[model samples]
Target: MKTLLKNGLMLDEQSKKLVKRDILIDGEIIAKIASEIEDEEAMQIEVAEKLITPGFIDLHVHLREPGFEQKETIETGTYAAARGGFTTVACMPNTRPPIDSVPIVEEILEKAEEAGYARVLPIGAITVRQLGQELTDMEALKKAGVVAVSDDGVGVQSSKMMKEAMRKAYALGLPVVAHCEDNSLAKGGCVHDGEFAKRYGLQGIPSEAESIHVARDILLAEDIGVHYHVCHISSEQSVRLVREAKARGQKVTAEVTPHHLLLCDEDIPEPNPMFKMNPPLRSKKDREALIQGLKDGTIDVIATDHAPHTLLEKQQGMERAPFGIVGLETAFPLLYTNLVRTGELTLAELIEKMTRKPAELFGLPYGVLAEGKVADMTVIDLESERPIDPSAFKSKGRNTPFAGTYVYGWPVMTFYKGVKTWDQADIFVTFEE
Candidate 1:
């Protein structure tokens, strides 16, 4: 099948300017991109006024499959990802039976291939069963098609265990992704250790909880020469530590979630569970630091730690509720409107961070839009406005705090490998006779 997309705008990387282009797709590859194209034999679609770019890539997300399928599954999660403009995502290894062995990793791959929505990259657990007791077979896991090794959802408490894992991963050419939480420091806490927790008379999770582990992991990675990455960075001190390490020329990288960038603890209207999340929304100062970190090159990528939980589990009160919120369906519009439209970040910067930067960081070839490349692209309505609605979400979870918030730059349509995956409003598409 062949299709031609007309009247689309793409950001020129070299000049950082929006340029008009017509893209032609043949089978699964972008056959041609030019100022104008005419093909009577091919079906054509008019995009009206929309921004076209490579499909977004997310480096961190949770797809609860294999054991915990109620909250999310490979099919539902990828549908949410496509709706949000993500074509490639790297899933964390925090399931009932964590991705510790070759078989589990292959299982996820098979499930994703069967789902046929988004490309799912499985991350292997650093420790067997994520117990932090013994390192998983890193070399074997790498050979079995794992991208990185991480014990996400919990920190590796044993420094000795973590160092050994780092050594093995480095030798095997695998990056070690750290969750960065010290159980002793972060344990028994609900909200961030800030004024909000104090006002609500609730327990606070100190910044030290995450920073301590970040510091330790960075030091170990620096000495052992492992490619290290920090996940869902939400603290001021952690930002400072990562900044210092990058300054020292360490192979350190960090990711920030949209919730941390878009909302702070002070933005939490009340003690509602919707506003609750692990590494809970931090102080106003920390939010500022995170933004500055992104602008100043201290942070490497922006990921949707798209953890989904059922409303029943999330409504269990602040202290008792689980630590997460659904993000895959709402990340782009929220960030584009709040950051890019507000002039805090340019359209190019946001797209660069969401697409190219992540692909380069994780070493994937799916984040570019050009001739001869796979047609994994999306068309976004940058000028259109819509209110955030969880009811329309494709994922099984509806635990977002951004519901009812009006936003712009929503994905109107998504194409993965030249196949239409998502079409908002069932927009117009023309087929030739």
Candidate 2:
């Protein structure tokens, strides 16, 4: 059966404004998008004043399956992705038995298929078991259906090993997603090396800890000529290096998380674990640079490093707690309310970064709405203003600092391949003519 979405607005990328349009979807494909449509046999739904957009594609996410089920599983994580208006998510390989081999990659794909919520693209571990020692079979991993290769939880410490991996991935036309960090410089640090750590007398992770590796990886990627993508940029120095690289016309890209862009070290009222994250929050100056970087096109996309941890684990002290926070649910609203609504970033710009830019970078074919395109779209309630509640999340983990924070632009419904994967029951607006 065909579905007609009437009285909806889609972001006009060229005009930089929301324009009224109607969409007709026919079984996994968008059949038409026009100013007006008349279809007697179609099932129509009214979406007055609502925004229809391409589904967001997340590049860095941790499903925590095949090992860490207590934190999150493919079913729950993809369910969270669906609720977050994401149609496709690329999960990092940081489980007990890391996705280093074909068997592990196949298993993750199978589980995601069974769940059938959002499309889960597994990122293969760059090094076998992510030990930073032995390189995995890049060609084989790609053949086994992995989109990218990464050892995300930790960085590859050896330059020689990293260079070899990049060369192999480049030969196979694969992207090398890096978690740039020098353990030697970052060890024993829980927060950024700034006033916040100084005031609390806590160990701090310096900018060099992350930037040094970023600088190193940029050079390696330049030499290897592989698509290099930096993950979760948090420091001013790292942003500068990427900006310079882009200026030099290098084949490099980087992503900044919402937490890193919105909050800095000073925002932490206390040494609370909720604010704890890897590459910890940087100075206010760094945050400003991130916003500028995004505006100036230095940062190519915004990706949520959605790492989920159990309540018991996150409740541990700041010094001992694991580094991460659940982000899939709050990323859009936080950025929408704080950045777009405040006039820092245009609504079209934010939507482009979250939807089309990431998909373009990863070469996925799901982030555009037009005739003959995939019917993967999201319906957003621009008027729905409410506080973010963790209890309402579809994921098993409820570890976020954005709790109690009010925001706008929540995703009310999502469709993946013409399938209604998620719909907000409270905001039913469907009506017959």
Give the local distance difference test score of model 1. 0.90
lDDT of each: 0.90, 0.91
lDDT of 1 by residue, 1-433 (tens): 9999998999887999999999999999999999899999789999867999999999999999878899999999999999999999999999979999999999999999898889999999999989989889988888888999999999999999999999899898898999989989788888898999999999998999999999999989989999999999999999999999999999999999999999988998888898888788998999999999998889988999998899999889988989899998789899999999889988888888888888888788878999999999999999878788787788898999998999998898899999989987642321111
The CA-based lDDT of model 2 is what? Answer: 0.91
The TM-scores of all predictions, comma-separated, are: 0.97, 0.97
Worst-scoring 10-residue span by lDDT in model 2: 424-433
Model 1 misses residue 143 by how many Å?
A: 2.0
lDDT, candidate 2, 177-282, per-residue tens? 9999999989899999999999999999999988999999999998879999999998889999999998899989989999999999989999899999997999
Candidate 2 residue runs with Cα over 4 Å from true position: 426-433
Tell me, what's the RMSD of every candidate? 2.9, 2.8
